[model samples]
Target: MLRYSLMRLGIFAGCFLALWGLVYVGALPRGLGDSNLLWVLLLSLVISAPLSFVLLRKQRDSMSVEIVEKVDRAKGRLQDNRTREDAV
Candidate 1:
């Protein structure tokens, strides 16, 4: 689970960097470099950061629920085993 989370985060970061780089490159004029491009990049990151956090949180929450359900099923099986042993 830890590894999975790490990989997910790494992928997200890598993609974000790649996108920012692409935008920066695309915004460069043919004959002049504009400083305002930095502001645009900053704004884009600010907007995307929160959106990404919300998305990642939702995914993590769902994964956690799945893990909990699996544990609950295992516990039920254990209880059933104990009940059978008692009856015998």
Candidate 2:
């Protein structure tokens, strides 16, 4: 899960930097005042979301399966502990 999150963050950073460069080079328009940074962040999310969904599908699926397995194991342990307490 951490790996997947880091990968998404990396993608967003790459998008933001690329967009920032475009603005610097006069390729893209910059927003007024502090809205410039806000625009970059929002645009980065819009650009990165689809890219991450497509590129990180396998990693995301594996992370989810690992989480489910962990939850199942925790539940099994809890059930066993409850049974032991009841018998005592």
Distance (Å) between predicted and true CA of 87, model 2? Answer: 1.2
TM-score of 1: 0.46
Best by lDDT: 2
Compute the lDDT for candidate 1: 0.67
Q: Residue 86 of candidate 2: its Cα lDDT?
A: 100
Regions more than 4 Å wrong, model 1: 1-55
Q: Write the per-residue lDDT of candidate 2 for residues 4-84, one digit (tens) a residue.
A: 999999999999999999988889889888798888889989999999999999999999999999999999999999999
Write one digit per residue (lDDT tens) for candidate 1, span 51-86.
667667867777789899999999999999999999
Provide the lDDT at 5 for model 2: 96
Among these predicted structures, which one has the highest TM-score? Answer: 2
**Cα lDDT of model 2 overall?**
0.93
Q: Each model's C-alpha lDDT?
A: 0.67, 0.93
